[model samples]
Target: MALLLLFASPLTLAFTLEDLKNQLSQPAVVTGPFIQEKHLRALPQPLQSKGRFVLARDHGLLWLLQTPLRQDYRITAKGIARRDLSGWQTLPSTSAATEQNRLFFAVLQGDSSGLQRDFDLDLTGEPQHWQLRLTPRSLLLKQVFTHIDISGARFVERIELHETQGDRTLLRMPESTSAESLDDAERNDFAE
Candidate 1:
């Protein structure tokens, strides 16, 4: 039964898309610390920034920066709201920008159906530690982002975004923060 044994061994290690989807557990809101480094085409060194973000499945993302400089971004039904020295202002919501933001949130929030519509996915590694590489399908999306790669050990720990203009951004959110109910900051963002 040596031939039978060989066939059985290979079957045991095969991992499917369903398996990866199950491995990713998306909470209603996942709050975590983040370190984002933007590598620009003209910049000699990558610009680093430290922040915290809240990812909500129904609402949107609340990104806050408390160090180096202060910045806040709240992505809600209205649009992407950014807070500067003046105050909170909503940016224009172009179709491309909206889709790009939704795609990022969908991938992180484990919305399998949303991801499947716009991206062709290739998953590598294993259940414990794995990578999901996405190639954009829509011509509009291709104009913005070339590819997106996400990796984690249980939860999503990192995201690398490659853009069409040759700029890249690497965001690390390895540390798990409180997944409890949305705080006051988060509540106000969605309320608006």
Candidate 2:
């Protein structure tokens, strides 16, 4: 019975919110291809876009779209910016956009404490596979999103946004790999 108890101890271990945060935060940089689907209430089909993303723990995210049309976006603490012929042009940050950016950063960076300010987070499953549900706690956030569902194994694999008006946005990072640091090009993009 003592041997059996010892073997079962690992199986009985509970995976908590803090464990999830630590697991996600372990990677300094993650690069992957993504598929984003925007489901509008009035549209018959969702709008799909393919892109590659670079997420750096200390800096920001670089969203480089390759299909349909090529566009590059850099999201940092200041705001969102787009790449053009001249240079990186900062986009106007509406309240909704700003909030969305903050939420995205929080989710990707494993900032559960920061998320608790405006959301009631429900986390489930083990470290290898987990699902997180975020319900809006603030009135402002409640007005825009009904709930947000995020799931992953080690890193964030998918994010689904359920909007108030029956619109939904699905982002899937199907293939992601961790890196020690960003390349020179990615580093330069963040600097700009």
Candidate 3:
């Protein structure tokens, strides 16, 4: 649930940010499944949820959570929306929220400039598998998130979010492919 960033460049001795960005050179669309696990300090067991997501490069992302509870989230250039028993509700346009959204959109586009603007970026691991670690440098982001780590090969496979409040969320997208054969719902998911 973070930057879907990757690079297409060749991997040499060391994996570079340029390489990651290039690997993620935009595909028309990305559709996949995601598993989210949350560990709360107040609670002993981790909360687990599994779902699917569709990321359309030209539009935005449609993230659906089915287990634990059913929830559908949409992130567009304008803002974030969640579907519940009622309907879509726009999230408040706070600076932190904006930064988070930018992280998602930029990651999908392999645009790290926005990410660099908000976090202390660190690139490590090898090309076959690499990790992008981001530490919040801004006071606003720091208040909410301590750090975010995204790791994968050709696509974003895992996202680890560390919150300053002692809660952590692990989002893993094990499989993903170019959505060249999008169905009616997916084809129009991001239009609105």
Candidate 4:
């Protein structure tokens, strides 16, 4: 009976790629307050931090880490930008050296199809709320992240990254909005 019950459990069910594709088809923006909890095996306790995220389609993203320290990251077609109170610095666009960061960009850009080429993707939960588990296929990415779990439905609510070094970072995103339009900013930021 126990064996039968184990085989019948819903947890044993696996999700298909179509399910993930369908979820990404929805058009929406997700802005929110966030908290990042970093846990290192060598540390006594998890280090907590706070932040926010602004996600818009066709435009780009603004990821701001505010708590433990203030930092900002912006990703656009031109490249990735890191900013602080001092100034802003731009990094090369998705290229060979930054494949790991590019993979992250692909995921955030809602291009799961592209991401599928580099990582094994899995999904769980209902339509309203779901969990996306990504396991890196590349040796370099695998060295950094064993797996990445992103939880949320229409909008991402949380992201947990499990690193090969026995460390993890849990990022929680609360529902919110961005007043500034990202498209116009991207255009200006990348003006030639």
Candidate 5:
């Protein structure tokens, strides 16, 4: 039947990792709302939190959380800083954290070749729509994240983080653009 054929075709289709690598190679800045669902193995239900993320290639990363409580975290080449409704605090960038930050920056910069050494990557779906799965090969990263799944086309659609503690957070990217430059404040807020 025609209907059966349509369903069967989709079930048998798959995307390769090379396809996903190519999709992520494009240059762009992505900013959007993100919903982080933290599922703990011991918890009865997953805790949901909402936030927004701004990522610029030359800049850094700005993560603003508006749900559960108001908070903001910025990661840049300088380091990672967090601010609550009250005040701002800077956190030391451990070697491990620096490595993680570099990894993220490298990926966003479209240096997929650099990432290959650190992650076992696999791609699925089609070029227009696909998922990139990155499993950390380093012992330090393996201790933190089990794997990271990124889905999207030329721009990232969503990022799913699977932690070693069995907690998973899903971040959805809704809006994105390419910028020639960012202001000083935006640069400071998103440095790494």
Candidate 6:
């Protein structure tokens, strides 16, 4: 009877969209390293980049790249910004860029409602492990993305972007840790 109770506990916590949002949103901050590979049809090899990222629930994402080149980017509801000698400079936001940024934030923040407005979401599996596929419902997004697949455990683990032009971008976050709040440096970066 005890064994049966132990085994059924996990199953009782069945996964649902709200459950996923709750799991993801419980963490105030998530920090990790990322490996991104962009596969282009015209290129023989995929372009790869390594970076560290900070995702603050109240703030935004800070992507610091250290690879073939070094660059920093901050993505917030306002827009995308790049770091340079002068400091954080806001990039010109195109419609496509705006849509992409919105998508990224929605996925990371578990804003399923935000995502539903633009794409048809198909989610499967349980809480500890699950997959989400986003099929573009909007004409503009359809031209840019074939579909987007995101899977994770406690936090998002990987994102696979399928482009309409036969290009693909795969992003992997092998390790992620959650925190109650951002560090001083991270908080300052978000402020900039």
Q: Top lDDT: which candidate number?
A: 2
C-alpha lDDT values of all predictions: 0.81, 0.92, 0.80, 0.70, 0.73, 0.92
Question: What's model 4's lDDT at 50?
Answer: 84
Residue-level lDDT tens digits of model 1 in 8-83: 9877887656776665544567788999999999999999999988887678888899778888998875679897
TM-scores for all predictions? 0.81, 0.92, 0.82, 0.73, 0.72, 0.91
RMSD of 1: 2.9
Q: Candidate 3 at 109: error in angstroms?
A: 4.0
Clashing pairs in 4: none
Task: For residues 19-137, write the lDDT of model 2, one tens digit per residue.
Answer: 88888888899999999999998999999999999999999899999987999999998999999999899999998888879989899877899889999999988887899999999
Q: Which 10-residue span in candidate 4 carries the lowest summed lDDT?
A: 183-192
Ranking by lDDT: 2, 6, 1, 3, 5, 4
* Overall local distance difference test of candidate 4: 0.70
Give the per-residue lDDT digits (tens) of candidate 3, residues 1-192. Answer: 233233423333566677777777657778788998999999999999999998876677889988877888899888998876776788789876876788887765556777788788898877668888889888878898989888887788888999999999998999988766567876555554
For residue 141, what is the lDDT in candidate 4? 77
Model 2 vs truth, CA RMSD: 2.2
- List candidate 6 stretches off by more than 4 Å: 1-13
lDDT of 1: 0.81
Candidate 4's TM-score: 0.73
**What CA root-mean-square deviation does each model show from the true structure?**
2.9, 2.2, 7.5, 5.9, 6.2, 3.1
Q: Model 3 clash pairs?
A: 6-20, 6-21, 6-24, 7-20, 7-21, 7-22, 7-23, 7-24, 8-22, 8-23
lDDT string for model 5 (152-171, tens) is 77677777889998888776
- The better-scoring model by TM-score among 1 and 4 is 1
Among all windows of ten consecutive residues in candidate 3, which has the lowest summed lDDT?
A: 1-10
Q: State which candidate, 1 or 6, has the greater lDDT.
A: 6
